[model samples]
Target chain A: MNRCAVIGIGQTRHAAKRDDVSLAGLVREAALRALADAGLGFSDIDAVVIGKAPDTFEGVMMPELYLADALGAVGKPMMRVHTAGSVGGSTAIVAAHLVQAGVHKRVLTVAFEKQSESEAMWALSPKFPFQPPLLAGAGGYFAPLVRSYIRRSGAPPEVGIKVSVKDRKNALKNPYAHLLLPDISDEVVEKSPMLWDPIRYLETCPSSDGAAAMVLAAEDSLGGVTNPAWVLASEVRSEPTMFAGRDQVNPRAGRDCAKALYAGAGITEPRRQIDVAEVYVPFSWFEPMWMENLGFAPENEGWRLTLDGATSMTGDLPINPSGGVLSTNPIGASGMIRFAEAAMQVRGTAGAHQVDGAKIAMGHAYGGASQFFAMWLVGRDKP
Target chain B: MGEREIAIVSFAEVIVERSDRDDCELLLPVLKRALGDVGLTQQDIGFTVSGSSDFLGGRPFAFVMATDVLGAWPPIRESHVEMDGAFALYEAWVRLQHGDLDTALVFAFGRPSQGPLHDVMSLQLDPYYMAPLRPDALSLGALAARAALDAGLTSEDELARIAGERRGVPTSTSEPYLREPLRAHATPTLRDGAAAIVLAAGDGARALSKRPAWIRGLDHRIEPHSLGARSLTRSVSTEQAARGAGALGFGADVAELHARFAHEEPLLSRALELPASTRVNPSGGALAQDPVMVTGLCRLGHAARAVHEGAARAIAHATSGPCLQQNLVCTLEAR
Candidate 1:
């Protein structure tokens, strides 16, 4: 297989409403920026791969057809991936595979969610025939999982608040981040209204309109890029949404995916070998939950890493230095942002949020009741 | 492009006018049959990918529930596409090229009967310009048929004959038109259906079937979305994909095309440039049983089946979008 590298990355400035641009304009902004970053044009791309959470979110079925012209995909192979919230990460992996499989030299992958176009909460909580109504939305569905994690790990209520504040503070450094909470503090998060039991309003991700894009190319296709983030390993694993012995708090798919990724990348200890990580933490508590799931910490002790400040920007292994989903969540693009931010970190182009001397990084995303998981390891050196 | 030699080992499908079963229920039997045909189980498969759309059921994340059919206890390497199953097969083929995996499972399901499929398909158009007009799929097809007639690419009588031949009915052009140039017989018979295919690579493919449909070349391409921007009388994407898939002069014994509208048959045939000896749609084609998402996959399955059954070579075509805006062409040979 040919080695694939991230040559360029771009993202939109996330906001509650980007009504100034149409859907085509929203995606073109990121695609153009990514092309500019690569110092190439639409004619250079061999294919286009796009992903989104669901068509219901945008009320457009298979929007890639309409978006072909906007993305300069005319006369090129264009694919649409939908794996729920992890779609963005999966989409990138698909694009990388195109290059790795030697089918295409350079592939453009984009993921976006114009949540301002429609109510995602309503789209997510649909009541099918003979099924009970889902009246509580995503936060409500996940609040119980957070409650279960707290019970199983014995984590204090303050851990979630700390993570919320930490990520928001990191967001202040990211110009494209949606929520720039300059005065984010534990007291403020604690005083916020409780949307769900054991889940505060400040602990959840906000609905933002944004798009993320990346240009992945084979080793030979890196024209003028000097700091391309070489893709070390990429993996996606999924399990049944519900089963008799499923572990919702720590899904087996996530564990298996991480195991495969580390093995492929030849990493024995993720916490030590990996310099930084950008994980999908839509809720603040997910940081700790996923840390354990990803084997960064021992079972039932992930919260200790949070309290010890090991995951902060200046800590030993900074997580989500680009603020993460908690600070800017465009459901479809959140995962790609995580992947793109990790690439930025390894390329040393993260500007203020750059982790010093970062050589290797990991990007993680999960969706569909945590049943689906996509992860990849990238490094400054070629694998 | 000598990547990896992949072939279709087995295929299974179910078609119904309207099924009360949910997506999982509709796919469980087909998945089981596809696995059983190759003497393998879900665990033995290296990767799994599916293509489906959420708009069909008016629900979000509808494909997640379909995973139950696999009994994925240890979890599996899986992915999905909001497209026809033929594209999902394309993804699986790419995954197998990594050399770590030997086999992959691809499937697709759709229940267009639950709602108005034509109206639902209109939403796939440009949201700002086309969707507001609510031009149903049939009307768009009519526009293409009119363009084809005006360009002298095909005649209304020829479309009627093609529709009659595909539907196994007698040709009668005197019938009243459904949309001027297009008659009721010129359209596909919509249905709810599901399809699954098992693919194996190299020696693995040889061990599974007596004769594997080795995929020599596979390619898909897209064209502009605006109807006015493209030549409706011809499918430029189809012609490009055919060239990329190396099917231009590679004469095949059979060709299976996912031509939902009867008028698309000649258009695709012209794009593919098939020899007069090549038999097209021996399995009745989409005009017989058109299952929104599964139709394209079924064409591939039928083409592969011809190779498995003794044909020397075959080519399969799958199309998407209005006026065949996107097309996938796969050339399979029995070697």
Candidate 2:
């Protein structure tokens, strides 16, 4: 297999509504940035791989077909990936695999969600036959999982509050973050209205319109990129949505995905060996939940790490230095955003949110009742 | 660069006008047959991927429920594409090149009979431009047919003959026009179906099938989304993809094409530059039963089976989007 590296990264300035640009325009904004970052043009790309949460989110089925021209995919192989929320990460992995497989030299992968185009609340919870109406939206569905994690972990109620505050503070440093909470604090998060039991509105992610893109190249095709983030490993795993004894909070798929990723990257100790991470934490409590699932901490012990500031920028294994999904959740793009930020950290271009001297980082994304998971490990040095 | 050899060891599909069975039910038997044909089970597959669209099911994460067919209890390294099954096979092909996994199972399902397929398909058009117009599939197909006719590429009688040949009928059988130039017979029947294909690489493929369909070249290309921006008389994407897949090098004995509309047959034939002796739509093609997502891969399956059945070389084409906006060509041979 050929070595692959991330030579370019781009993201839109996430907002509640990007009315100025159409869906195609929204994607082009990120794709153009990525091409510019790589110092290449539309003609340089060999293929295009795109992903999004659902066609319902934009009321357009297989939007990539329509976006062929906008993304300069004419006369080029273009693929559309959809594995629920992990689609962004899954899409990136597909692009990298093309390069790794030596099928293409330079592949452009893009993921986006124009949530403003439709009501995701309705789209996500549409009534189906023989299925009970569990129309609580994303927050309601995850709130109980958060409640279960809290009860099982026995972490103080303040843990979720601290995560909300810290990520929001980190968002202030990210110019492209959707929710720039300059005045964010734990007290403010605690005082916020409880949307779900023990899950405050502030603890949940906001619906935003944005896109994320990256240019993945075979090792030899790094035209002018001096510090490419080498793709050390990537993995995707999935299980049925419901089965006997299935743990939703800490899914087996998530664990297996992380295990494969770590093993592939030759890192047995993720907490000590990894320098930074950008994990999909749509809900603030997912920080600890996923930390445990990813083996960054032991079961029920993940909260302790968060409580001890072990996931903070100045602490060990800083997580979500780009403020994560909670700060800018563009559903489809959320996963790719995590992957891109991880690549940025290793490239030493994360700006204010950069983890100083970060050499190795991990990006993760999960979707659909947490049954699907995708993760990748990137390092500054060749793996 | 020469790619690692991959072959289709087994293929199975079921096409019906409409089925009481759900997507999972439609897929289970097909998958079982495909796996059994190769003397393997779900566990034997190293990677799994599927292609499907949720909009057809009128719900999100519809493909999630289809996983029940895979018996994903212990979990599996799987992924999905919101496309036709042929594209999923393309992904599996790419995955096999990693050299870690030797076998992969690919499947796709769609039920066009359950929804307003024409309107639903319009949703695939440019949301800001074409979708707002709500142009139905037949009218769009008619527009392309008219373009070809006006460009002197084909005649009305040729389309009728193409449609007749696919239906095993004669053009003398008069059919009413659904759209100005497009007769009812020219349009494909809406079908509900699923298809499964097992792909194995190198020695594993040889071990699986005595007559494996060796994929020599596989490539897909897309065109601009706007119908007005393109010349409907020609399939540039098909030409590009056929060239990429090396289909233009000479000709194959048969070419199973995913031409949902009659006019597309000639367009693709010209694009791929198939010889006159090349048999087109031997299994009646998509016109016999166009099950949306499944039809494309079914074309591929049929073409692979032709090679497995003694044909020296064959070509399979799968198309997505309106007016052949995107096309994938795969050339297979028995060696």
Candidate 3:
């Protein structure tokens, strides 16, 4: 692949209702910021690739066409990618491919969701298929998995509350975070209503309306930026939702994606080597579950670290220092937010929320019964 | 030709007519054929990508069911786009440039019989502007056709001729006048289809096929959706894209175009401006099988096939979106 570097990253202020701007306006907010960061204009972008969770989530079918002008993709190649929750990461991977493939010098990638305009529950309502309809709402789907993790790993239920409290507290530093609960505590999370067994309202990600944008440029396009997050490695994986003997818990797809990401980036010990991680844990328990899946910790022992405070914001390895999905969950953009946040940490551009001395960062996201997985490892140095 | 060569090592298709089974049922066959054509299984294809839309199926994550047929049991590198199979193929091509994956599988499927085609397409128009009028694809083409007529780019006779030549079969025949200005024969037939293209790198191409359609140059461009701003008669986007791809030459052979309407044939012909004698749409093109999202990929596959099959020296052009709003020109030649 050609040398590709992320010169600019931008995001809209995450919120519950952004009625002030239309969907196009929501995306432009982030795109313009990213362009300015790259020290370039829209004219410098050779192509655009967009990603979002579902069309029903925004009530726009193939929204990229409507978004072409706002993104300055007019008279340029534009492609739309959809991979459930992992779509944001997948969208950036496609943009990176433009530079990596030696096709375009620079590509603009954006992912967003105006959840205020549509109901995620209604959009996820499964019909016309033989399988059982999604009933857990957003949290319900992951609750059983969380329960399985607890039962199989012998993890105490309090571990989830710890994650929720830690992420919400971290949100205080991120002004763009939608749910900045500086006052949130473990007791507050535990006191919240349990929407799903083993999962409380506070332990789950919020449905936010926001957008994230990143400008991926061929190495030659980089100019004024002193620190650039050269993309080290990227990978995406998928598996059948249901098969004869598929393991939804500890998904093979997530494991494969992480394995590829680490191997590509030449990371031998993710736990010791990875400085900061921004994993997509829409539900709190997933912080440990994905830690195990990504090989950051053993399968059954990941929760032990969470309980031991080894995975805290100031612990051995910081996780989701930007409040993660637990802070601002824009469903579609949530995945890319994780990816861009990783880039920001490496570029030393993550405002007050920056993880101090962070060098190697890994970003992760999963969608659709945890079957879709996209991840990338970014470092301070070009690999 | 570029430094790294891209090739269509294998292609598979499933014509999803009013069949007894569902769209998913149709996918297994096409996918198997595409993979088997290169003597490879799902595992042999290093990366997987797909394209589809939820509006057509009236359900979110419609493409999720496809993984069942793909047998992603061990999990595989995969992604999806909501555009067309052609764009997905482009994504695969880009991924292959990393020298990570030698072969990639690309596919797209939709059931036109399942949804109201015009209304679903209306969902693609400018929401604040044209969509309110419920401007279906035919009307959009009508506007473009009227513009072309006013511009004297081509005559109605040229469109009628294109309609007659694009459809050679009987059951799927085209008549004059579906939406005044766009004869029924002139409009590309609305059909349901599933298309898959297996792309390979230079070394992979050498290993897969004796003759591979070396993808010399592939480029795609989109014009703004605003009807008032864009020139409907000519695809300036297409011209710009062909120029960017450096695919402008008097192609001595042919150009397999994705012109959905009869009027579009002339407009795209003017935009890409293929040689006057170039054989266009010999496979009846989209005029007989206008499978929206997959049609553009089909045009690309057909052009590549023309080269690998030793039928044409070079082929250029593919037109997409409503009223030729977006276009792609991929110059192909056999190495």
The most accurate candidate by DockQ is: 1
| Best of the two (1, 2) by DockQ | 1
Question: Model 1's A-chain: what TM-score?
Answer: 0.98
The model with the greatest TM-score is: 1
Q: Mind sharing the TM-score for model 2?
A: 0.98
- Model 1 / residue A382 / CA error / Å: 1.0
What is each candidate's fraction of native interface contacts (fnat)? Answer: 0.89, 0.81, 0.78
TM agreement with the true structure for every prediction: 0.99, 0.98, 0.97
Which whole-number lDDT from 0 to 100 does residue A354 have in model 1? 95
Model 2, span A160-265: residue lDDT tens: 8888888988888898999988888888999999988788989999999999999999988999999999999999999987666889989988998899999998
lDDT of candidate 3 vs native?
A: 0.83
DockQ of 1: 0.88
Instruction: Report the C-alpha lDDT of model 1 over B193-219, residue by residue, as the tens digit.
Output: 999999999999999999999999999
User: What's the true lDDT of residue B295 in model 1?
Assistant: 90
What's the DockQ for every one of the candidates?
0.88, 0.79, 0.71
Q: Ten consecutive residues with minimal summed lDDT in candidate 1 chain B?
A: B65-74
Candidates 1 and 2, the one with greater lDDT: 1
By lDDT, the candidates rank as: 1, 2, 3
| Preferred candidate (DockQ higher): 1 or 3 | 1
